[model samples]
Target: MARRKIVRSPDLMLLRRALKHLLPGALLLAAAAALPRVPSLWRLVLELLPIYFSLVFVGGFLLAWQFDRSRIALTLLVLALADRALLHGGHNVHDVVALLLPVNLAAFSWLKERGLLTPRGAIKVGALLLQALGVAALARAHSPAAVSWLSHPLVTWPALAAVPLSQPALAAWLIAAGLAVARFVTRPAALESGLLWAGLTTLLALLAGKTEPLLTFYIATAGLILVVSLMETSRSMAFDDELTGLPGRRALNEELLKLGSRYAIAMVDIDHFKLFNDDHGHDVGDQLLRMVGARLLSVGGGGRAFRYGGEEFSVLFDGKTREEATPVLEKFRAELADTPFIVRGKRRPRKKPSLPLPAGSQKKVSVTVSIGVAEPDGSHGTPDRVVKAADAALYRAKRSGRNRLCT
Candidate 1:
């Protein structure tokens, strides 16, 4: 049975991994096929194609292997814009900017991967600002009527407002907007590429004698800002653990306020966690926490695991009453008790050096969890009260027996 289980594990992992790639590719292909309509869109698509192909392949490959898809896709778009600018023989300020934006955005990921961007992503913000400023300057330099007075806020505001959007600005704005959408849809790369595309397109359109530059520039710039801002907000929310991800206690309060529907809220607590942490070490305790979270997520479906501080987790199940969720929760609780958490490879070397325990010792510790289940009591009150009731039930389970569930 153990051999069969070990053999089956890799196959399960492989199947789960494949779905992530297949689903996104199918969605992107559908979107790409449906988005183009006008002659100008065709022209834009044509200009973007080579770079797009190179980006999709190279970016997809790198992302599939190492990084997240959204970031890679966004980066690829930015690189594509740079390649487009270089191909068009742009040496002017707009051309230089077209080259720099994507690179800067890509740099954010590099810094982040190294764990260097924490405590505030100040460097990353600075880089983005620099790119924005460069694009603004380049756009200003191209217009002779505005060059002398570019520094004058009153004089430049109108042009700055319209450059990427006017008939003279339309091309750049389109590119910028496309890049912005890509960045938000995918990751950070879109940001730089979008700005460059917008800046360069605007300059090219102006030089080529486009009519109605003002309306074109305003709409494009404003639209990109709005889209990118929304995407950034969404991206932040999606990656969060949802329960403990927000700072302070505000996140929990916010979630409690939003509860609705006939949902089952499960409050799970690690059985004897304080003693377990003391007996093994905090390192093992941390691993136990993560393992418990993973188990809860696996059994409770993909979308509902929440770290409700310390060794406690709160899971809200949609489409199930409290009674229906009980058996499923109990089964998972039993699984946790049955599994032996051997802390060998999972421990940090520096945390317990030279303390010679058997390399494969299973005697050090074991962990289990207790869960309190609650259903929405419509007449009982708010979500907070519901949670408190569940907590009371969880305490009851812990008192009755450490590794069990109570409703």
Candidate 2:
């Protein structure tokens, strides 16, 4: 038998994904870490960094808006507004705003985790309004001496022991770390990864104890996250089937190269698909294919389904024999036949003057599939050859009787 191709392991895949999202931020962090070493560069960067950050955040907001990512746009806007306030505000104003920053970030992360904020325009507008009110309140309000405990050495001791961060800042860092771990373990989405990297970069900047580098890293990380998100979206479009939401032929080809020894391949075709398409409208035919694809997606026996092409699907049973796969294929075929597909009736224009008008009544239709199973053996030495054998067996099934299986 042909040897399986060396493929990336799960840990390797996860690491690759993390690195892809973190690379840009990593570069920014490196640049920021080096800035304090040179006085002239540091001064120059400090003088111009605020302007650069302002433009970056503004441009990020516009891009997010254009992409209909309202939540992200609002986030960028909030960051921009806070940055501006900190740059121009007095000491008391800075302290109040700085205290609010972590609380806001943690709350936003919580809302995102629970899926409460869905990037809707109304939600974005409301959030922005609330942020504006909070900023206004902080601007006019004095720091309460009653809450002076917040800045006291006693209150700061515990946080300092853990990290050289304040309470609110520590809380925000913890929230970001938790979000990143959850995302990597549970879902591993691009946006989540980006947010995690951005958060880490923010924390790193804070640890460096430099104001200019902090702002610079913040803007750089935001821009990188946006770019990565767009790249991931485009990749999804290329790999996923638009109609059935299954992996397409290209995906199947890639998967085949990764299979190990002792696997079974099944070629499935809808029975009399062309005749069905001709009798019913093409739209109805498309619906039938969709239904079949959905059913194949849930196939058991350790099988993974792919939309091979029009009216055909391929199921691969990793580490299975023909005997192991046949029963599962039979079960799927039987279930498909038993389920009735209902098509709502519609009035059609009369083709001939003599023909009477048809009544609008719903019609029930059923579809059946013929599957052919083949396993790797001496005769079929390669995956492609095994697929061909399954295809030949599929033709045999069609010839024997439309809806039967052939091994």
Candidate 3:
């Protein structure tokens, strides 16, 4: 019998990260599905669609500017322009937008974010101008002929006819979707995932007819997702440590505010971390911090970990006493001491390097932590004071002996 390979914690963590970025768009899409389908209100909603989209796009542009996510701002600008073109121009322009949008969106999203006021940004601006000019030129030059040529079905099969898009448009959507998926898989971020779902919503809008209320609904949803995800990304960047992927000091500060009277705070510090950093390098030190943060995430006793800056970390145990949390912190300290951390050097092998280093290129070493647990007391009335008390205990722990827990 063949053995089944088990999925580990890191894989699950990666999956969670990918899915989290999809939440904003997915929620809006769900809301769109649940909208009331009343006949009387439907026309009103249709009339309001353009107005609604105008607000969403304009507001989204301002937010993108605030967050400095230029890609989202530009995408919204282009989408707004397309909406305007479809409203003013005829069938040829519709065909022009249907064919051009997916391709342009793919280009805008996949291209590196060059800031809007720069040389590269000028090129992007030029591209936008060219797209608009092409639509106008084509509409005036070809009249109704452009629609027939652009909408010509590539396949005569009955199944293919049921698809709501023209051949070139469908092909472009498919390629754009593939790129979005690939980008999301490689680096799970708001931009990549937003591009993936926003592209789908745009395609759905095209399927429903550009001037239809459904178009407004999907396009508005797309704009909202782009804006909201950029906000989410901005929040994540603020509260998360870039190197460790752990909650930073600001997050810890907010969390501390929400704690009750009986909570325990444990300050954890890696022993001789500076010596390690100096001996190895900052890059290696970063790797160590990430590894340590990962381990801290799995600490026991209902504790939530935060990267409390540098080589220090903090674990907040809501509603737990100091005595109760001490043993848990001790166990964590001992377990971390036992786990061997492999330090990969410049000459380390491309594959996973195993025991017995080849001329000191790689080596396995045990890392340990000193922990101090504190509970709220009359002496430490406030959260900040409690943290200071915990730090004092941590200093005591370090003084007594390294790699041990203190009360």
Candidate 4:
């Protein structure tokens, strides 16, 4: 029989990052296509072209000002062109495209530690916003029969417009707005509803006639959502440990790379771990590992706890110097020393404490762990070296005598 291959999935955070790139482009493209309905939109695009050029020029002027994501930034620029090519001139693409702003910002804020609204995030947001606003102005000034949705800032702002004058436009805008509100009230779960609303609106526009631009916008929105979902699923599987419910080694490396300054990295190992497995058999050994894993998680606080593989784990303390994490580490050591492991064949109805155990049957087994501590040095070549240092220290602790900590 062929062995089953493990499938890795992206976490919600990665999906959100990918969407960060896709949404801006898609939104700006929609806005660009919506232009031409307002005469001023053309003039603004022309006038603002120079400004956008300047932004591109000065985008890297200050290290702090830069998003450092040049590839995605350039992609947004290209998307501008695509919008004009596919859906230009007084179209009904605004409603769908406008939805991207809230979706993008909200997802970034909630799912990822980093967001599009972050300093770098704001730059992309500003760029895309400027483009959308410029288009709305151009479309209104250019076309006499053009609708208010294509003109007024209140109506055209990607975040939330003032409300359009045209009944159809106003109706569409209102519907989109309502869905957006609902999504915000309950994110993740409600996010799908907002997407559905956008999709349904596009369908309505198609049935009403002159649906080319609307259809294009709808297809693109759906595509962006799909891309983000796919990436998110992949990110999760890559970063999280399946067995211990902690971060996997790959995720630890990624987290360390993003570390700002002054942090602690600690290595934890079950004391005499191999002996437990040999004497009690693999099943009991697994139970002890899980118990230790739970204790580590309890003491991890806000820091990330990761499984570094069999019988080994790690924790990262952010924004704190080594001294700051010492108390926490000591606390964890003390708490874990008291944890117990249930031997095979000694369980009640439920495995853990909350569930009632069978009356009169209360016997459990247990084990302990040793730890090694290290402070991260940004100047150091890589996270691996730092982790190795902690690992070495961990071995020293075990040699000195199991169930003790070393730095």
Candidate 4 regions exceeding 4 Å error are 1-227, 344-355, 358-360, 376-383
Model 1 scores a C-alpha lDDT of 0.51
What are the per-residue Cα lDDT tens digits for candidate 2 across 1-407?
A: 75322211124334544666556556655666677678898788678775667666767666666665554565566566665666555455545555555555444444443222454556646766786676667566655563454444435354486554456556656765786667555645555555555556555644544364565556455554554564564565676565665678888888889988889999999998999889887877776776677677778889988888889889999899999999999998887777666553345331223753354443567778998999988999789999999999999999999798999
Comparing 1 and 3 on lDDT, the stronger one: 3
RMSD (Cα, Å) of model 4: 14.7
- Model 3, position 243: C-alpha lDDT score: 69
> What lDDT would candidate 4 get against the real structure?
0.54
Give lDDT tens digits, candidate 3, residues 151-213: 777777787677766787888888888877887888788887787778777887777775556
Task: Compute each candidate's TM-score over C-alphas.
Answer: 0.50, 0.51, 0.88, 0.44
Better of 2 and 4 by lDDT: 2
Give candidate 1's TM-score: 0.50
Task: Please give the TM-score that candidate 2 achieves against the real structure.
Answer: 0.51
> Total clashing residue pairs per candidate?
15, 0, 0, 31
Off by over 4 Å in 3: 1-13, 36-51, 142-149, 152-156, 346-362
The stretch of ten residues in a row with the least summed lDDT in candidate 2 is: 3-12
Among all windows of ten consecutive residues in candidate 1, which has the lowest summed lDDT?
Answer: 3-12
User: Which scores higher on TM-score, 2 or 4?
Assistant: 2
Candidate 2 residue pairs that clash: none
